[model samples]
Target: MNRPTTLREAIEAADSILIGAGAGLSAADGDHHSGPVFDARFADFRDQRGITDAYSGGFYPFPTSEERWAFWSRMISLLRYEAGPGQVYADLLGLVSERDYFIITTNVDHRFQTSGFDKEHLFYTQGDYGLLQCSVPCHDATYDNEKWVRQAVASQEGMRIPSELIPQCPRCGEEMTTNLRVDARFVQDAGWAAAAGRYEDFLERTCVDRVLYLELGVGMNTPSIIKFPFWRRVYDNPEATYACVALDASAPAEIADRSLLIRGDIAEALASARG
Candidate 1:
């Protein structure tokens, strides 16, 4: 049988599904870290600072907190609020929504939540654009930034937010930063811990069942988190199947027979599998 048909059969046969997603999934959905949208939204950064994309923009060392918050606020609004969960995410959800499934993703955009996945069944290992934590990490907590982000995006001028709008950590008065897992300073708040526990629980409950480890658009940026784990689990569980759909896909020879590798467009592969 063809790869997509084989993937369809695997999904149908599995008692539970575990989805692992990465930046490629969002990129395939046109929500790239840097692209036309980034260029258009951050033209000033591109022209003046040579900061081309959201990914690099986050790392840019702005001279002032006002400038830093201005860039970040707009980025959060654009990536987290303004961008829609494109057809790729929706299509992927459609294929697994009817089954017992859980999703673990490194992408910070919250696309799975936006695409109608149950929040309780999803684990976002890399934090979120919609959350902010102290740069010094004064406490183990994150603050919601939607209201502040939209406000800053509206009130900013000259690529600087009004000094008054800059978020300060409520506990220690330190400056706030995106809650992404870029460094050791990243905060794992109560919600994050709870989600992690639930993910572990899901794995324990389903480990012996006929599980399908479906990885979508995952790449080498963080193999240990999803890609490697999926391979290891499939190797350990004879009843399990491993399927990967990405622009590029590969698997070790040991589990080659149990692996269904589809190297192509993610959306197309998902559609074919669902058929």
Candidate 2:
């Protein structure tokens, strides 16, 4: 495999590329760290000990389902619609949008799409912060979450957040909420279904072609979705060339000969890649 010193070289060697993004991408792009409430709550959780962001938080400690919904809805409200300007993400998208590419991200914040990426070209592996779905997995429908999130902020009462942010289903009117893919029961409403179909279709169309895989700011904590499977795919495909922009500069040992491992910040590396 020939190593690329510039963006042109990277594109010349491969037919198309598939991008995988993670939290670090948004962080590097200057989005605020979760939220002010996040810092306070994280400290409090640690102060109590033995308690973490519960995986099955919808069913976690709370006298009633309403309280549980309150905690989770507040969390969802903070992370999705609310974030910093997306100039970094938009710039990155401009560089790649011209090429035959598809993006998959674990970021629930709609940054990629908000930055002008076509909605059909992206697959948000994690549920979107901007959308709400039925908590009971009733049917495939989604609603914009902005109104409720705004309501939550407007009705703010101290650090606990406003109760109105907690969403309820429109159909059954029972506990409707963000479609964040945190566990086994996450619902994929209409938009999710369409996005997922595009993702699968992208993979299908590209299956017969040689692909360039670009991984940005992904790490091992969620190895299966972002990091490790990427390494495995590149390793298994002899025609593929891999590149990653990560804080840790390490290549899959098995594919080190065919990969470009850049140890740097994502926004900086994106600049380098574009140049």
Candidate 3:
């Protein structure tokens, strides 16, 4: 059988699926952090400060908190709030929507949830773009930032947000930052902990069965969170199958016997598999 059909059959036959996603999957959906999209949206920053992409801009040292929030607010609105469902994510959901499936993604874009995947069935190990927490993380709490982001995007002037619109930690009056896991200060609030628990419970229950550890677009930036564990699970469980789909996909020689590697566009592979 062909590769796509092989993948489809594996998905159909597996008792459960654990999906590990990374940036490539989102990129296939046109959610790019750099390139033409970034150039167009952040032209001012690029021309004035050599800040080219959203990722770099996040780390840029703006002169003041107002300017910093301005950059972040624009990024949050563009990537988090305004972004729409991706067809690749929808295709993935369709492939295993009826099966016992759970997602563990390092992606912070919230694409899976917006694409109609069950929120409870997902573990976003990295923090989300739609959330804010204390910069010092004085407390373990995350606040939703949709309203603030929208307002900031609408009201900002000359690459600066009004000082009043900058988010402040409710508990300690310190500056608030995106809930993304840039450092040790990233908060793991009640919701994050609950999702982590669910992921662990799912792993405990499914690792023993005919599980398909389907990894997509994952890279080497942070392997421990999803890639390494998925490899270990498949190695330990004889009934498990490991599949990876990416533009440059490969498998460790140890798991090669039970692994399926699809090296190509993630969206195309998903579409062909679904067919």
Candidate 4:
């Protein structure tokens, strides 16, 4: 059978579906880390600091904390708060909504939840954009950051936010940081632990069944977490079908016969599969 036909049949026959998503999925939704959108949203930062992309801008050493918060607040607002879930995610939901499905994603944008995926069936291994934690990490806890981010985006002027608006850790009065997993200090609170447990339970219950391992836009940045594991499971379970839709997806020679790798835009590939 042809690849797309094979993939459709696999999905139709599987007992459950497990989705692994990466940064490319978000890129397909127009939240690319670089290019015209980056330039347009952060032209001032690019001209002043020579920081070209959102990823690099996070590390730029602004002279003051106020200036740093100014940069981050706007970035967070644009990427997370203001940018609602896009069509790609909605199309993905349409494809899997009828099936027993679980999602584990490295994307921190909260797109899965925003797109109406059940929270109990979703696990975000990385932290989220809508949260803040103590920089020194006095404790394993996270605070909702929407109000502060909105304030910063509105009150910032001339590359600096109001000094008084800078977030402080309530426990120790230290500076606050985004809940992104930049280092070992990232907080994984009770909610994070619960989600991780749920993902583990889902895998345990479904891995031995006729599962469809659907990976989307996964790259090698953190292969151990999703990519490598998916390949290993498919190799171990003959009944499991491995399928990937990405701009740079490939199956290893060992699993080539049992895998379907579609190299194309993620949104288009999903739409075709849903059809």
Candidate 5:
């Protein structure tokens, strides 16, 4: 979908637009799966394992879970919490911040907020890598991971992290785990709860407006969050327009009745939106 000729027509008629973004969107914004950082950082992992890409380096499979956590802790610090803020995320914020919009994303990188989306309007459905939660889920609290992560970086030696930040459950005094919600045990920290409330409020209020459900960079991996719900809403609301921009994007077979499928890059699509 090159810049749409009817761009103004689309937004002018749209009472509201809910932006659902994912890793794919970031890819277009200049953050791909692998780039210079991964190239250099995983040189060690590659030499030892005869592989390529930090993604593969991460899944190299160390002997112990402790070793795995150590590797991941550093990775998390670099990827999720401290990316130093890039241009792509900033441009994305510029693209949508002015509009009547709210974002729900599963990406744990925290780029949306880091680049300046209002924290109140953005909901990170997955737990952020910048936070730590109980592995056994002994309690509801999610401690600030930034401090603990920095400690790991400072104390690590010979490929092992210090025992101090072994990520134990603060409530039950068990091993602390990544705040990612991979399973039922994943803890929803206080921030997560508040974000969820805001997300619910957005849906509750926007459902009444003439919404333009903008689904960007979302794929089948987790269809429920972006694809299914948005499509359902579009189907229910005659005034709604389901505009999805993705690489080789296609909606559910049944959604053919009311959907505008734009198959292309997000930057190009946003340029179309800007038109």
Candidate 6:
């Protein structure tokens, strides 16, 4: 059978589904890190700093914490708070809603939860845009950053937010940074720990069953986290089937027969599978 037909059959026959998503998935949903969208949203930064993309802008070293927060707050608001969950996320949810499903994604946009996926069954391996932690990470905790981010986006002037608006860590009174997993200092708070445990538990319970490992838009940036592991799981579990729908989808030669690799738009592939 063709890859798409095989994928549809696997989904229909599976007892459970595990979805692994990455940056490409978000990009497919119009949440691109670099492109016209980034240029339009951050024209000022682009003009001033020659920062071409949201991802690069996030790592750009500003002269002051206030300036950094100004840029980050606006970026977060555009990508997270202001933007609605895209249809691709909703479609993915529809495909697995009736099944025992769990999502493990490297995306930090919080789109899965926003698109109505059960929070209990979703694990965001990367940190979220809505969280902030101490730069020094004096404590294993994260703070909700919506209110401050909104305030910065609203009040900043000339590419800088007021110093008073800069977020401070409650524990150590140090400047705060986004809770992204950029380094070892990334805070995995109680909530993160719980979600991690849930993901592991879900895997243990379903890995041996007739599970469909559906990988979407995952790339080699962090293959070990989701891609490589899913490949390994499908290799180990005779009943597990591996399927990937991506712009560039190809399986290893060893698991060629057991895998479905659909190279195309993920949203289109998913919609076709659902039919």
| Regions of model 3 farther than 4 Å from truth | 1-5
lDDT of 1: 0.89
Task: Give the winner by lDDT: 1 or 5.
Answer: 1
lDDT of 4 by residue, 162-216 (tens): 9999999999999999898878998999999999999999889987888889999
RMSD (Å) of each candidate, 1 decimal: 1.8, 3.8, 1.9, 1.8, 3.1, 1.7
lDDT of 1 by residue, 111-158 (tens): 888889999999999999999999998789898999999999999999
**4 or 6, which is superior by TM-score?**
6
Error of 2 at 266 (Å): 0.9
TM-score of 4: 0.95
Candidate 3: worst-modelled 10 consecutive residues by lDDT: 1-10
Candidate 2 residue pairs in backbone clash = 168-176, 169-176
TM-score of candidate 5 against the unseen true structure? 0.87
Q: Whole-model Cα lDDT per candidate? A: 0.89, 0.70, 0.89, 0.88, 0.72, 0.87
TM-score of each: 0.96, 0.81, 0.96, 0.95, 0.87, 0.96
lDDT of model 3 at position 19: 94
Report residue 234 deviation for candidate 3 (angstroms). 0.6
Q: Candidate 6, after superposition: displacement of residue 15 in Å?
A: 1.0
lDDT of 2 by residue, 1-275 (tens): 46665444665677888888987888888764444556564444334433344333433556544444445545556555555446668668767788899898988778887688888889888887778788786877778877766666556443344454567777787777567776766877677778889888887787656787888878776769867766877787787777887878578679888787778778777776566
Candidate 5 or 2, higher lDDT: 5
Alpha-carbon shift of residue 204 in model 4 (angstroms): 0.5
How do the residues 158-189 of candidate 5 rate in per-residue lDDT, one tens digit apiece?
A: 56776665777756888887777768998887
